[model samples]
Target: MSNTGFRVYLNINRPDPSLVQRFGGIAVASIADSMNRASCISGKIKPLNGAPLLGVAITVKTRPGDSLVMQKAMNLAQPGDVIVVDAQGATDNANAGELMVTWMQYRKLAGLIVDGAVRDVAAIRNMTFPVYAAGITPRGPYKDGPGEVNVPVSCGGVTVKPGDIIVGDQDGVVIINPDDAEDILGKIKDVLVRETKLRAEMPWNGSWVDEVLKEKGCEYID
Candidate 1:
């Protein structure tokens, strides 16, 4: 299937939030990386720890130099939803900013993940809301021409559909294909269990790595 068609299918099939929460962030990232390497977007943008953002998605499509559609998205978004804008990887114009964030906060939305730039970094940092974008820009955006809302779009190099659960932290953003949510949840559970065991066995002295490497016929040179 074409990329657009695949995205459409994934969006219509919303993922189960209960299962997604069961798996958590680490598990979801691992699963998505294993299934589709391109699904992971690397960066340091994240949400405040313990922020309440779950089971929500706001899909958007905007031109490289337009912002009207994004504003419309903010106006139309409901509570407990994250805005995901596909700006076609535009890093020049700031499609989002403080005012938009203020509006989103008023609506009690989850967070925002944009494929373009955003302004008002300091304001966003102070707010409790989570926002992940490619970069920051001092220049704002021009609201003109056309844009779409509630449509499937790609953000942070990952394709996200409407109503998809978006979990963000210091790590980054990962998209969970709605149809595969259940299966991914099961896999993530297994991973979490295994990691728990490994965590317990890890030595406090930081010698666990050396021991494991020795077992693999490798030596650490001081």
Candidate 2:
């Protein structure tokens, strides 16, 4: 028998609102290296709105092509929570659309990141609501589903649990597990500074590689 009901967790520990905002303030690429480069959601998840987004994750794991639990997720979300949906990476049909987006906006949720497709792009963009999705289609999602909310779910190949921080921008989206967000956030600014300094020191002419080649005594066409 197929499981068609929904499961939800009402209580999840999320980061402090101020802390999430601070993490969001930094560029997604800024903390890329610090996270060991493994936490980024796929590049396919592009920003639907032309701005950055940051919030705690309200994870939803639903059957492919279904969004029943996603609807329930909205009820559980707090202001500034990012709805992170795991739809098994389905690409043919949208997992959510305009109505859901509108409701979420009214609730003052931070943003959305779906590891699947989404419809009603025009309305979503018009609202300036940040949304990242795997793809777009006119096809909508089915509500009848077997799913779970506020649980650990895989979004764009990354395991995201409720309360984890979600940061997305034009570059891409990444999941900062609640366990590591604070520690990583503490050093991200310093990492950014060092990165900026290192970048500033690099030569645009591409001669930096010559030192290593010379060290190895490699003879090659310059």
Candidate 3:
């Protein structure tokens, strides 16, 4: 039973609302650190507006220069779903624009992330709805698509499946598997606490740097 292409997965077991809420408060950097800094989407996909993003993933795998499946994904996604489109990192064609963004806003989607390009930057930049993409171009995407919805896809160098938690901030985006989210959340708490203590240290501490240098047998110039 291999449905290789043009697939659609309707059901996704999203994380609990409380867990999503809890993740919403934490910074994406902290979440990345909790995961050993390996689950982050590539830094090339940047936020159009400086807004925090947190939501369940609604994965879309579209042809390099097409938006048909992405449009279908928009219709299928529910509120608080972040539509993460794997557009194969195509920047020559913009996958979405202001009109689509407005529709997403009207639908109350949490955010949108495209591993490609998007047009209508001027208009999208003014909207509060979170939008992140790898590039911008005036060229628009083709509507006819051989694509899939709600399936596992690669976006910005990260494998994302439907229902994965996506957290984004000014820094960038990171994907979290709902099954491991609780454990990651625990580690994030520890990271936050450790960061707070480090921040509270009035004078910067370089003793650890010296210790490491000494252990490595580095000769000091002075």
The top-ranked prediction according to TM-score is 3
Better of 1 and 2 by lDDT: 2
RMSD of 1: 5.1
- Please identify model 2 stretches exceeding 4 Å from their true place: 1-5, 202-208, 211-222
Candidate 1, 1-222: lDDT as tens digits: 444411222233444556656545454355654454445555634443334445577788878757787777777676667788888878798888898888888888878878888889888888888777777789889978477777867676567778777765565666666666676666666766877887998765778778888899996679
Stretch of 10 with least lDDT, candidate 3: 2-11
What's model 2's lDDT at 138? 92
lDDT of the candidates, in the order given: 0.69, 0.84, 0.92
Model 3 regions more than 4 Å off: 1-3, 219-222
- Give a tens-digit lDDT track for model 3, residues 110-222: 99999999999999888899999999999989999889999899999999999999999989999999899889989998999999998899588789999999999999786
By lDDT, the candidates rank as: 3, 2, 1
Any idea what lDDT model 2 has? 0.84
